[model samples]
Target chain A: MHNQIFEKYTKADKSSLIPLLQEVQAIYGYLPEDALTDVSEYVKLPLSRVYGVATFYNQFRMSPLGENVIRVCRGTACHVKNSSNLLFALEDALNIKAGETTRDKKFTIELVNCIGACSIAPVITVNDDYFGRITTKDIPSIVKKYAGKTKTNGVTVTEEAV
Target chain B: MVELTINKIKVKAEDNMTILDAAKSVGITVPTLCHLKDLVPSGACRICSVEVEGFRNLVPSCAYPVSEGLVVETNSPRVRRARKTIVELLVEDHPQDCLVCVRNKNCELQDLAERYSLREHRFHGESKEHSIDISSASMERDPGKCILCGRCVRVCNEVQKIGAIDFTNRGFKSIVTTPYDKGLNVSDCILCVQCIVVCPTAALRERSSMKEVSSALESRTKFAVAQIAPAVRATLGEEYHLPLGTDVTGKLVTGLKRLGFKKVFDTNFAADLTIWEEANELIHRLVNNEPVPMFTSCCPGWVKFLEHNYPDLIQHLSSCKSPHEMEGAVLKTYYAKKLGISPKDVFVVSIMPCTVKKFEASRPELTEEKLQDVDAVLTTRELVRFFNVAGIDFADLNDSEFDNPLGESTGAAAIFGTSGGVMEAALRTAYFTLTGENLETMELNAVRGTDGVKETIIKIGDKELHVAVVNGIGNVREILDQVREGRSHYQFVEVMACPGGCINGGGQPIHQKTDKVLQRMRALYEIDKKMLKRRSHENESIKTLYKEFFIEPGSHVSHEILHTHYHSRKK
Candidate 1:
C-alpha cells in the first residue's frame, strides 16, 4: 500500500523524501513506523535520518490522527492575543495536552504556529470549521459540538465518540 | 591554487581546501570541535569560527571554502572571544563531573575549555537532564556529557554507513539518537562502537567488563584465563606512551598475569585455528560449487552488520566463530578437559581491541550448553583503565610469554589484527591445502593497504581465486549489493568493520592522528615478518590439537566446537 505513494519517486532519490513523506502522511493521516522503514529503504537513507526529518518538521506526526484535529494557532499575533488560555481551556475540556490525542481519539489538540487568519488574533480550527477570537468559556461548547459524533469514510456517522 | 592570508601570513593551498585546511598549511592551527578528518565538515559546533576581513560575521573555517585573496585571522580578538564563549557555553551545560568521567583528560571539550582558560561556567540556568542509555552490552550513551559535535554521527553515517543514530528534534532539544529515541540495543546498531571512537567526550564509551573480570579473577573456585587479541598488542602500547607501531605482546602477557589471571593465552592461536576452519570451509564451498564468495567471519561487528543489513547473503559468511570466541570455546572444552577442571569453573576473559567483542562474548548463538564462549571481554582502553586502577605501571613491566597449548600461534595469526590480514592468512593456508606446498612469498601486497576496499586475484594450484578485502563497513555495501544481484566476480571477501581493521578498532587507545592506525597496521606486519612459523598449517601446536582432539579441519567435531552459523537480524 505504501509502494503506491513511492511510485513517482526514484529509488535512492533523497530529494523526493519530503514529498514522499507528505504523500504517505496524506494517505495514512500520519507517518506509520513501518511506512517510514519502507521510505528509508526506498530513499536509501537510514531510518534514523528519516525519523530525524519527520520529528524536525511539525507537520509530520508519528502517531495516527484522531477523528478531529483541533489546530490552535500559537503564532506571534495569536500568542499576544492570549491564545494560550484558549489552548489551556481546550485541553481542560478534552483532557488531552497539545500534540496529543484524547483517550477516545475523538479529538487531537495540535499547537500550530499559524492558522493564517491573524485578523481574529486567537483562532482554533476543528476540521475545516474555524472558531475565531474564542475565549476560555467558548472552548467546552465548541468541543462538545464535535464531541458526540464522528465521520467514518467521509460520511457523518451518528454514534457515540467512544 | 587559492591564496589565503591566515593571521597575516599568506599561504597557497589547494582550491578545494577549506579555510581550516588552508590555515593549517601555514602552521596556523585553528581548533575545531566538529571537524572530522576526511569527512564532510558538519560545522555544528562553531569553535573554528574565524574572522574574514569582508564578512560581517565570523565564518566557521571548517566549512568555509578557501578562495583567492581571502584574508583570514585565526586568533584575532573577535575570534578568540567567540571561541572562548563557545567553549564556555558548552561547559556551562556539560556535566561538571569531569574528575570522575571516563574521558576526563582525553575529552576534546575538556581540552577546549582548558585551552580557552574557562576557569568558571559563566552561563548557568537550566541544564538538560538526559538519562544514560546502558541497554547495549557493548556501547554506552551518556547524553549529559554529549557536546553535539556530530563526529560520532558522521563516523556512524558516513564512515560506517550505519546510521543507527542521528540528530533528532531541533535546537536546544536536539540529540543524536536512534529512531524514536530508542535504546541502541533495540535499534539497528551493530554495536561496532565506531561512534564511540569518534565521539569527542565520555558521551560514548564501551560498557566496561572490569568489575566482572575483577570479581571473576578473585573467585576461589574459578580459573581466570585471559586471552589477548593480536591487534591489542599493536595499539595497547599507545596507552603507555610508547612509540607508534610498538608491539607490546610480551609485556601485555605479563600485565595479564599481573592482573591475577591464572593463565594468559593468545587469541592469535585461535586466529590461526580460524584459518584452519575458514580456509577449509572456503575450499569445501569452492569444490562443491556452493556460494562463490565466502566472507571472513572474524570481525564480530562485520558479522553483525551482515546479519542486520545483508541477511540474504548470510550463507556467504564462513561458519566459523571469531578468533576470541574460538579461543574461549577451546579453553572451556579442550583445555579445561586437559587440565582436569570443569568448564563451569573456567572464567575466560578476552582482551580484544574491538568493542563489539564484548557483545560477541554475550551472544547466545555463539554459546554451547548455555555457556557463553567467552565470559567477559575488555577492550584495550578498558584493560588500560583496569591496569591503572590496579596501580600496575606499564612502563616498568617485564616481558613474559603466553601459557602453552592455546597460547602458541603462527605468524599469520599476528596479522589478523589488520584489515586484509585474515584474507592473506587464509590464502596462505588455502594454498597449502590445495597444493601440497606453501607459496614462495607470504606477503600478498595487493590485499595489504589502508584503502577501504582492495581487490586482487591469487593462483592456487590450477584455480585462480578472486578475492576482495573491505577495510571499512561503509565500503561493504556496494560489494554486497553486487553479490545480492549475482554480479559479484570474487570468490572470497574479507571485511573488517572498523576502518583498517582491529588495529584502528573502536576499543583502541584514542588519538587525533590517523597515522597511528597505519603504524599499528605496520606493527602487525612486522610481527608476522619476524616470526619463524608464518603459516597456520605449520603450527605444531595446532597439529597436536588436531591430532589429540579435533581429528582434522572441517571434521564434525571441529564444526561442533569451532564453527557457528549466522542468522538474519533484520526485522
Candidate 2:
C-alpha cells in the first residue's frame, strides 16, 4: 500500500472515493483487499461502504488480472446453443469460478452479457481472438493454448475459430 | 406553515415537511416501508406513493415535499393499485414460510400485506437463494427475506456509523451484506443488532438461545439460574401488551421461576457492584492523573466498537464486565460455592435488553477455568417467546419476589436501563467515594433524554468533575476525535451503542411508536425514586458480598472476578 496515489487527495475527502479507487485499481490492476482497508481510512469511509461501491460498479475488479482474459458470453443467442456447458467445462478445467483469476494469474474467466456476435452464437473469447460455436470438448484445448504462453508473449493469431 | 389538502381535509404543516408529514398531521395514514423518522428518506420502497393533483406519476409521500395548495390523495384508486402491486412484487420474491418466522405476527411487512388485503399470490418471480448468516453470536441475517427497503443499511450507516453491512452488487443481484460478502463475525460488525430493530421482515433477528436454555433447565445435573437486566424490566411489558414502560420486575421473576429456573436474580445487583468498582476505579484514575475520560464498559456493543475502531484507546475503557456478566460471574463463583455446586454445573441465563450481550457472553475473557460465566443469553424479545412457548400467562401471573442476596439492589442500579443512567449512578457513588457525601440532587437532568450526546459538570466539594454521556455510537466520534488529539477535558465518559440506551435496545419489542423510549426512561427513574436505597454504596447485600468474598471495592479478588480485559479486533 504505497502512499503515492493517496497523496493526490486530501484525507477524509469523501468526494474523491470513486476517482481514488480508480487510481488504485489502475496501479494494481485490481482493487486489492488490503489496499481497500487503507483506502477506507484515507477516505474516512467504512470498509464495507468502500467494498460496496467497488462491487456495485462493473468498471472495478477485486481480484488480480491474469495474463489472458477469457470471456464467456451468456447472452440470449448463446443460451440456445448450450454456451453454459462450455463455461462449466472451462471452470472445471481451469479450477476457477467465473470472474475469478487463476491462482498463478495465467487465465481469468468472466461471464459477459451480449458481445454483439450472435452469428458466432456460442462464443468464447481468449484475449482478442474469438472462438465461435465452441463446445465443452473445445475448452481443454483453448485452456492449453493460453497456459503455454509466457508473461511477455503477445497474441499474433487474429483469426476467429469456429 | 404550508397549507395542503390531504384526503379532502385541509391541513397546515411546516413548509419543509414532506407529503407524508402533511398527511400524518391531518390523521391520514400513509403507509411507508423505507421511511425512517429522523433519517434521510431514500424512497426506495415506494409504498407511500400518493396521487398528487398535478403530478403525472404518483409521487412518494415520504420524499415529496409539501407545498402550498398541494392536493394529495393518500389512498386514491390508482395509489392503491400501485401500492398493491409493490407489495405483491415484494411478497413474490419473499419466502412464504411466515408461520415459522421469528417475527411472525409482529412483522411490519405482514401487517402491510394484511392492510393491503393481499390475499392472492399475484406475481411469481425467481427467488434468490441466500444462505442464512448465523455466524455472529448476537444476530442472524437472512437475505432471502430482505425487501431491500434499506432501513437496516441506513440505521447501520447513519445512526451507528458502523457500516458493517451495505448494499452490494447492482440491480436484482443487490444485497445488504458485509465487506467481501463475508460472515459478520469476521467483519468489523460489533454485533449491535440495531439493524435487527429496523428490519421490517424476518430478514434480521437475534440468534435464539431459548432451546439451549430449555434443555439446560430440563437437565437434572444443570442448576439453571436466571438474571434479568435493569432495562428488561422496563421494556419487556410491551410484549405482553401491557402499558409502555410498566416495570414488570416482579412478574418477570415469577415467570422465570415458572419456567423452571431455581433462582431469579437481578442484574441491578451487579449494576450496583459495577458502580462500587467503577467509581473507585474513576477516583483512582482522577487522583493519580491516569487516563482521563475513562469510558464506561457496560455496553458490549460500544466496547467492541472501540476495540475495532480505536484499539489504541482500549486502555481508557473500564475493565469492569457488564452488569449481567458480573452477576453471572458472581453466580458461578460465590453463589455456586455457597450451594456446593461446581461452576460448570451452574448454568446462568441472562435476560437482557441487548442483543450484544449474547456476543458479550461468548467472549473468552468473560469466562474462568474454561467455563463461561453466562451459559446463554436471551434478549427481552426472546424472553417473550419463551413465555409464549411455556404457555405462561405473563400479565395475570402473581407478582413474586426475586431470590435473596443477588436479587437485592439499590435505586442507583435501577436507573442503569436508560442513557446517562450509568454515568448518573456512578457519579452518585463516586461523589460519595471522593467526598463521603451523596449528591444533593439525585437526578442528573443533563444526561437524561433521547439526545445523542450529553455533557454535564458537577462540583463535588473542591473538585469540579466534567463528564459526557453518549447514547448513539455515531455521536461518539466527535468526542473521541478530541480525545485522540489530546483536547478532551472530561474526566469521565459513558457510551452506549443504541440511542436512548438499553430501553430502546435492539432486543426490545420492535414498534414504530414515538415516545416509547422516553416513557421507559421515566419508568426507570420512577423505580429509582421509589427504592429504599438510592445509592449503590447503601445496598446491604453488596456490602455483605464485599465483606464475605471480594473484601472491598477494587480489590485483587474483585479485579480477578469482576473485571475483564479487551483486545483489538481490527482486521
Candidate 3:
C-alpha cells in the first residue's frame, strides 16, 4: 500500500517525499525499510540522515504493529491506582512487554501518561478505544478478545474489545 | 544598558539580563529558590513565575529574556495564582517538619510559607519518605525535604563539573541521588558540601560540631584555641548585617574570646605556612624532575576529589594540609609544647568557611597523641550563631588583635579563602625562592578571579610554568579528562570544589540569588587587592617561624607535621 502511494506521489516535487513517507507510516503504523529507500530516492536526502531523524524522535515506529495495540495509562492518577501492577499483568497475558509486539504479532503494549481522562484511572486503551475500571485479573480475557478466542470459564470475548 | 518596564516602572538593565533581574533592579522582589548568580539558571522551581503582557501563560522571571518595550507584572493576580499554585504543589509533597528541620528558621521554603501566608496544606498525599543518609563524614542527605530544585545538581555538574549527583527517577517519584542510590561515602563524592550550600531545604546539611565545641568549653579541663579561616574574615560580618566585604577579623577574634576560647588565633598564619611548604615542594618537584604539577591540598573537597576520582594523580597533590587543619595539628603539637601544656590539655578548634573542613578534621590521619588534630569545626554561620547565643554584638565589639605569633598573616593568607588564591600565593613564593629575586609585582593576576576553569603560563627564570586553576568540580572533570586523554596543557593545576572558592563554600551563608553571591565574591577580590602584604613569604611571623623553628620550608620536620596523604574511595 505504501509502495503504491509512493509511486503515485512521486509525480509531484521530490521535496514532498518526506510528507508522503510520514503519511504512509501513519497509515501503516511503522516505517518499513523499503519506504526508506523510496524516501531517499524521491526526496534526494541521504538514507542515513533520514534514518537518523526517524530514530531520533520517540514518535516514529520502525517495526510492524501487532493486531491489537494496548496502551496502559501510567500517569500519576493511574500510577497511584497501582497501574504498574496492571501493566505487569497485561504484559504477561499478551506474552510481550510494553514497547514490544508478541511473537505471533497478535498484541503490543505501550505505557503512557495521562490521556486526560483521570476519572476512570488505571485505564487501558485497546486499538484507540478506552477500557475503564480495568483490574489485573481482567487482562487475560481482554487480550483473548483481540486473538478472536474464548475461554472455558464462559467469559464471552466481546467482538468490540475496546 | 537595555531599558525595560516592569509594572509601569521603567528600569535600565544590562543587555541579555532576565526580566527577574530587571524587576529586581527596579526594587521589585520576586520569590525564587533555584536561581544562584554564579550558577546557570535552572528554571526548576516555578516560584519566580510572572505575567508578561504579551505571553499567554506565566513564565519564570528568572529565565525569561528581557526585551525592549517589555511589560512585566511581577505580582499580578494571575502571576500570584500561578506562583501560589506552584508553591502549594511543592508544599504538598514537602515534609511538614519545618519547625524541627535544621534550617527551620533559615530555609527558603519556610520564608515562602510565611510570605504567602500558607497556614495549611490544601493538597495532601503520601510524601516521599527517604531514609536520611548521614554516612558521609562531611555532610548529611535528607531526601524527604528535597524540592527537586536541581541547584545541587547544577552546582555539582554544571559549575563543579563533578556530575557526582543527578536527578535519578522521573516526575513525582524523581529524586536527586548518586547513581543506583549508592551512599555518598561510597560514591565518587568529593565531600565538597557545595551541594549542602545550594540545597534550599534541610535535604542537605553539614554534620554539626556545635555540641563538641560546647562540651569542650564547658569542661574547662582543656585550654581551647579557636582559629578563624581567612575567608571567614571577609564575609562573617554579613550575618550581623555588616556590609559585604567588611573586615570582621577583630570582632571575630573578640567573639572567639567571649566563647570561652583561651586563645583566638588566625588561620591566615597557617595559610602562610602552607604557602612556604607548598611552594618549596613545587620547586623541589621541578628541580628533581618528579611530578610536574603539584596540586594545592588546602581544599579538603579537592583533596577528597583526587582521592576518589583521580587517585592516580595523588602523587601530584602538594602534601600541605589546608591552613585550617594545619593550624589545628600545629596547635596540638608545637603550640602545646611552647605553652608547656600537655597535648591532651589543648583543644584545637577551627572556624572555617567550609563544611568539608569538618570532614577533614575527622580524618584519622590528622591526629597526634591519639587526639584529633582539630577538636571541633565550626562554619562561619555557626560562629555567628555562637555570637548570637553569647549575646556578643559583633558591631559593638572594639577592634582587637589575634593572640601572638599564630594570629599574624599576609594578604596572600587572606585570599586563600577564594579560589585560585592558593596557586597564586604559592607562585609568588616559588618564583622568588627559585630565582632569589623579589617579584616586581606581587599579584599573580592571571590565577585570580572566579572563572570556573582558568589557565595561564608564566616565564619564571628559565622555566615556563604552565598552571591551571579550577573553582568548581564540573571544571575539575574537564581538566581531569584532558589529563586522562594525555593532552593536558597544564604543568600545575589548582582545584577548589566550590564555584567561587571558600567565600561561596557550602558552609557560607545562603544567598537567595546567584548575583548577590557573585557580588560578595567580587567584594572579596577587592579586599585582596587593597592588602599591604600581598605575598605569603613577605609575612614577618612566617619568616621568623621558618628561621627559628622549622629551619626551612619542606624540611622533614615540617613535612611530618604539616603534610599528609590521600586515599582512593571505592566507587
Q: What are the per-model C-alpha RMSD values against the true structure?
A: 3.2, 2.5, 9.9
Per-residue alpha-carbon lDDT of model 2 for A1-162, expressed as tens digits?
A: 658888878655689899999999998889998889989988989888999999999889987889999989999999999999988999999999999998998999988898888887788888877788777878888889879985444544333455
User: Against the true structure, what is each candidate's TM-score?
Assistant: 0.96, 0.95, 0.76
- Cα lDDT tens digits, model 1, B481-568, are 9999999999999999988999888899987886887899999999999999999998889999999999999999998989998788
Docking quality (DockQ) of candidate 2: 0.82
Interface RMSD of 1: 0.4
Candidate 3, B1-571: lDDT as tens digits: 7777898898888888998888888789999888877456778788999888878888888998887788888888888877777788888888877767778788888778788888777887788889888888778888888998888877776666566677754566677786446577766677777788778888999887888889888886878889988788878887777777777778888778888999999898998999888888887888898875667888888888788767887787888888877888788777788889999988888998888888888898887767888988989878887888888888888877999789887777777877778877887888888888767776677777767778888788867989989877667766776777777767778888787788888778765544545556666566667778778888898787777777788887787788888777733
Q: Taking chain A of candidate 1, what TM-score results?
A: 0.88
> Candidate 3 at B99: error in angstroms?
3.1
Error of 1 at B118 (Å): 1.4
Which lDDT value does model 3 have at A126? 77
lDDT per residue as tens, model 2, B529-556: 9998899999999999999999998999
Using TM-score as the measure, the top candidate is: 1
User: Which residue segments of model 1 deviate by more than 4 Å?
Assistant: A10-12, A151-162
Q: What local lDDT does model 2 show for residue A145?
A: 80
Best-matching candidate per lDDT:
2
Q: How far is candidate 1 from the true structure (C-alpha RMSD, Å)?
A: 3.2
Lowest summed-lDDT stretch of 10 residues in model 2 chain B?
B120-129
Model 1 residue A122 CA deviation in Å: 2.7
